[model samples]
Target: MDLLVETFFNLAIMREALPLLLRGVLTTLALCAVVIPLGFAGGLVLAVLGTTRSRWKRFLLACWIDFFRAVPPLVLLIFVHSGLPFAGIELTAFAAVAVAFLLNNSAYYAEIVRAGIESIGRGQREAARSTGLTATQTLTWVVLPQAVRNVLPDLLSNTIEVVKLTSIASVVALPELLYAADMARSVTYNASPIVLAAGFYLLLLWPVVRLLSRLEHRIAG
Candidate 1:
């Protein structure tokens, strides 16, 4: 038991790694702040475009979304970080992460938003339009609000997945939480830093998980 504890839960190594890990937490948060908004905004635009009656437009949008969703985010990130340089488009690690995540996550968010939008009854839109509201105004005021509410659970769930996915940025040496923990582990020759990082992730995500559960139950009820 002592040996296991020392190997996996050494308090001294955890203490030593705490500051670096905290900085990593901040980086992860900042990455989320940047990418989440970008992804959501991009997704909103795509979802809105998807509402068009034009067959070609819808087909193109579907292609775009499917392409991004099909590509693994890590591979996309590596390409953005490493491959683009050959094309004379060099991006910093942070910027590359932002761009890659934006592309990958926007597809996911768009799908969720699109589903939410489709759930609204066509009668609501016709009613709103009959009231002299422009098509855009009707969508803005009537459809989107209810759509978002109906899919609130799914959006939050996707956001949680995005947060977890941010750990993959470590592969680019972005010094995110997992990367920092791995660095500390290498330096200290102890697994405690990794455990500490897991603790941080659990602390960060547990409340969201619980809240999502309550929400799902409420929605089901």
Candidate 2:
């Protein structure tokens, strides 16, 4: 532990890499900030479609979820960044990374939302319908509001996952936190710089996970 502290202050964090690493964190956070919400939106749409009674819609939605969930987001990132241009759908490096995360995170979020929706007792829906509420109205007023609350903890937890997943974007030449670490390591020929970068991510993420834990506990309680 002392060695870690010394390495942190004596080597990378003490050197000029602090600001560069901060820039990496900024980029990572920015990428997630955009993609996380997009993922939730996509996931919500997917969940709604998947829960529909139509077999065709459920099958199609399941196909989409399975495809995205099966493929690694890193592979998707590479395809978007390098492969898509061959077909004329060009995307910037940032756009590719963002789109990949948005799609991947959405798949996971859909499952979370679906679980929340399914947890609702069947009586609630029947009760709403018996009150003369339309299907859309019952879903909007009775189902979604309660389901969203039930799923808030899952959503917060997934935000942490989104933050971690941004590291994969580095392989596509996006200058996320891990990429900054690699750059610093290359220049310094030092492992400490890379450790510092990891520390930065942990430092940023730990508190978030802790807060999410509390939120989850509160919601569960």
Candidate 3:
């Protein structure tokens, strides 16, 4: 219908918005590149610390993990961006969003890594011990390798989740895909820009989702 074409298939609007959308794509990729490594590294460290016999250490990290997991991402973002300034701790909008995302991802990744490490057989630990490996050596060299292998799919799935969560950064005016689309819509007063943004998101994420699906299947088998 003409209405559908006018609303969604408008070529002029697409041409106008293409550059903004592409810039958003690059910003999003950059955010993900930073988030995945730091977040996962924090989580891995927390998970490893959680394996300790020290109950208090476990309790402290548990509290941190639970707090971040329970807080909604948007709320956390706002708190980091707005609330911290009250305590004389100032952060740029981008830094705040990145920190919030890192906290969120670290909490989830900690749990995933913990579960993976726990799933390793006790016999394997004993075998490592019998080979004259200390507990730390066994954990670092043996158990972690297998655990990381087992959790690869879950980690990739979480990375996909982090990708989607980047959209939340728009609330802070981070100019990611959603923000770019919003700007274009405000200027043009048409929904076509939003449609284009949605298409971009789909194009970016659908392949990752399918690859995740395949990884899940392979892991399961």
Candidate with best lDDT: 1
Rank all candidate structures by their TM-score, best first, as comma-separated numbers. Answer: 1, 3, 2
lDDT of 1 at 168: 98
TM per prediction: 0.99, 0.89, 0.94
* Each prediction's number of clashing residue pairs: 0, 0, 0
Q: Write the per-residue lDDT of candidate 3 for residues 56-148, one digit (tens) a residue.
A: 989999999999999999999999998999999899878998899989999999999998999899999999999999999999989998998
Those runs of model 2 whose alpha carbons end farther than 4 Å from true positions after fitting are 1-9, 12-14, 219-221
Off by over 4 Å in 1: none
Model 2 score (lDDT): 0.84
Best by TM-score: 1
In model 3, the Cα lDDT at residue 149 comes to: 84
Name model 3 segments beyond 4 Å from true: none
lDDT-better candidate, 1 vs 3: 1
RMSD of each: 0.7, 2.4, 1.4
